[model samples]
Target: MKNIRNFSIIAHIDHGKSTLADRIIQECGAVSERELTKQMMDTMDIEKERGITIKAQSVRLDYVKDGEHYILNLIDTPGHVDFSYEVSKSLASSDGALLIVDAAQGVEAQTIANVYLAMDNNLELIPVINKIDLPAADPIKVAEEIETSIGIDATDAVLVSAKTGVGIRELIDAIVERIPAPSGDPKATTKAIIYDSWFDPYLGALALVRVFDGEIKKNQLVKLMSNNEEHQVLDLMYPHPLKRQKTNAIKSGEIGIVVLGLKDVSIVNVGDTITDAKNPTAEPALKYEPAKPFVFAGLYPIDTDKFEELRDALNKLKLNDSSLSYEPETSIALGFGFRVGFLGMLHMEVIKERLEREFDLDLIATAPSVVYHVYLTNGDMVEVQNPSELPSVSQIEKIEEPYVKATVITPSEYLGNVITLLISKRGMQDKMTYLNEDRVMLEYSLPMNEIVVDFYDKLKSISKGYASFDYEPIDFKEGNLVKLDVKVAGEVVDALSIIVPITSAESRGRALVKNMKEIIPRQLFEVAVQASIGSRVIARETVKSMGKNVTAKCYGGDITRKRKLLEKQKEGKKRMKSIGKVNLPQEAFMSVLKMD
Candidate 1:
């Protein structure tokens, strides 16, 4: 146990954390050179294509230091703010962490946020400067910035280029010398925390755990502390990149995978505690708290008959991604669908894409919205996730929307543009600090609704892809808000409804109706598209009817005969317009997002 080190790699997106992880695994000789791959820790196809880590992965490594064998358990964590929950769980299972900073770009918003999470877990941190081979690399300046901004002693910060494999040997030595080994009683009752869980087709549900006390052996009956359910451990194995190695027992202070031979992954929930059923421990290793979703959106199959297939796909996907939550809902415009909850916009995008690719289903996602707290005149409050669910304006007293503390770090040149963007999104400045001569960190309190749309994309574009942003939910605050509903040819489409602040409701309604006019197909009769707030219409657009030659056959007839034919055609159009149904294309549903 003294030679064992349990740690995780933490950094901002595109800061060489994944590259550093690849280098470390190579140095430890975990995989052969012929089979080694880039971003080995990121297993998903979407992750590889996008160059991002969506899920946290772990691997065990063996190293020889000074002629002594050492065991290292390394957890590679996601850097995006959406997957911070994954980082928190990974940090909880680690005794130390390696903080990687880009030599060209010093501390970032996510870097500071993750540092706080590591600090809360009381994990030892090792600062490492990466990308030192780049022409713009400045390790000394970054070290000083880390010291001032993060308040960490970076005098001994390791300088290494993860891309070129420099300083890897010395970094491994530092991990062995600095990071403390796991400490727990091997003779005590079995106690371990399930840091991660996933479903396997052949093996059923598997849990990656860190044993704190005693040992978990094959065929042992273990009880889950969260639900008091017991299951027999069918197998035990240590984690690796290419393949997992079989093991008979997982001793204390070690990380390994436990197989329960169950079909459901929910039974082996993440953050849950596992202990011996007969010799139960007095307390759990860690308290379990499931992730809370902040964004809600409706996902509907393009083919309404495939609703059941969508449900089945969701269930299977949930086995792999436990953060996803959904419930059955029906929309008048889109028919039967599910109202899904997501951690953020990126998470919602990834899940939607996965369902379409993995299950071979066509899906349409509604505009994402945040949870709203609506207070009634009778002193009662109701939570609203969908715009259609909001009570009538006459019955409601006030509405409050969720807000978050947004942190942005950008170059000095983009400070004005970043501030302007934030202000346009209804963000209130909180504080600003100068991290260095050329970088500034700005903090603001922004509504969660604004961030869920296209805030990240706009930020990246405005900053020229040189800024990093992170946010945490703060609280709900009262706002002058109203529910905006869309009417197509006199019928309300529930799926097109959205909530907007009263101050900007008029402009938003105008923009929405104008965008919808271009998407709604022209029918034989004129279609009136209207946007309204309760009973008042704020904006309206007309899709002119397709012209037809009603009097073309009457060549030399009297003028009165032509007039009679036109009159008859007008009457028929009036009747058709009353009973006509508009078929809204997928683009019409997505038009809500394009509303500027």
Candidate 2:
């Protein structure tokens, strides 16, 4: 236990955290160079294609220093804000963290956010400057920025190029020297905290846990602290990048996989404690709160017959990803579906893509919305997750929308453009500070709904990809919010409804109707696309009827004959307009996502 080092790599997205992990693994001789692959920690294809780590992975390595053999357990964490919960859990199981900052980009928004998380966990921090091989790499400037902004000593920061394996030996040596070894008692009763879990068809549910006290061996009876469910441990193995090595037992201050022979993955919950069933301890391991979702949206199948399949898919996915939550819901325009909640827009996109790719199901996702507190006139409070479920104005008193404290880090050259972008999104400046002469950090309070859509994309565009953003939910505040509904030919399209601030509802509605007119195919009769707020139409667009010149049949006919034909055609059009039904394409349901 004294020679065991548990640590995790934390950094902002695209900062080469995964590459660093690969290099460290290679340096530790965990795998040979010929067998090694780029981003070995990223096991998912989506992660490789997107160049991001979606899941947290763990690996154990053996390193010898000064003739002393040591066990190094490294947890590779996701860098995106959406996956912060994973990072927190990884930190909970570690004694220290390797803070990797890009050499050129310096400290980014996520870097700052993750630093606070590590500090909150009281984990020792080791600063590491990555990508030193880049032509524009400036390790000195980044180290200075870290010292000034994070108030951490970075003079001795490890400088390395993960791609070329330069300075990897020095980083390993630093890890062995700087990170404190895990402290626990092997003689105590078994108590372990599960940081992550997944379903295995052959072995049933498997839990990845860090043993804090005592030992767990094969065929031992164990209990889950969360639900008090008891099961026999069928097997144990050490976690590796490529394969799991069978172990007779896992001792204190070590990470390993536990198999209970349970087919249902829900039985093995993440963040739950595992203890001896017969000789249980009085106190369980430290409990960690699950990640709460910030955005909610409805996912309906394009084919209504797949509702049950969709439900099964979500259930299976939840077994692997505990953060995903869904409940059965039905829409008037769209048939039966589920109202799914996600951490952010990227999280939602990943889930949707997974469902389509893994389960082979086509899905239609409604516009994402934030949770709103509705104070009814009848002295009742209701939480609204779907815009179509918003109560009528007559039944409500006031609406409160969720807000977030957002932090934006960028170069000083784009400070003006960033401020303008935030202000347009109804953001109020909360604070501002200069990390140095070239970098600025700005804080703002913005409504969650405003930033939940295309805020990140727009911010990146305006700042020319030099700005990074991160936000956390704050308390809900009273806002002049209204439910904007779209009516196509006098019928409300529930899927196209949204909640918007009163000030921007008119413009948003007009833009939505204009986009609808361009995308919605014209019918035989004129179609009216109207945007309304509480039965009052605010914007309208008319899709002209597909016309056929009635007078063309009689080009040289008399004036009276032409007049009669024109009148007949007019009457026919009026009848068609009354009875025609618009067949909206899938693009119509997705228009709201692209609406500015």
Which candidate gets the maximum lDDT versus the true structure? 1
Best by TM-score: 1
Summarize candidate 1's per-residue lDDT along 475-582 as a digit string, tens digits. Answer: 999999999999999999999999999999999999999999999999999999999999999899999999999988998968999999999999999999999888
> Per-residue lDDT tens digits of candidate 2, residues 1-596?
88999999999999999999999999888898788999999988889999999889999999999999999999999999888988998999999999999998899999999999999989999999999999999999999999988999999999999999999999999998999989888999999999988777798888999999999999999999889999999999999989789999999999999989886666777889999999997787887887788999889999999999999888778867778888999888888999999999999999999999989999998889989999999999999998888998999999999999999998999999999999999899999999999889999999999988899999999898989999989899999999999999889999889999999999999999999999999877889999999979999999988878888878685799999998998899899888877877878887887888
lDDT of 2 at 519: 94
Query: What's the lDDT for candidate 2?
Result: 0.92
The CA lDDT of each predicted structure is 0.94, 0.92
Candidate 2 stretches greater than 4 Å from native: 547-576
Candidate 1 lDDT at 51 equals: 98
Q: List runs of model 1 lying over 4 Å from the truth.
A: 550-565
How does residue 402 of candidate 1 score in lDDT?
Answer: 97
Residue 406, model 1: lDDT of: 99
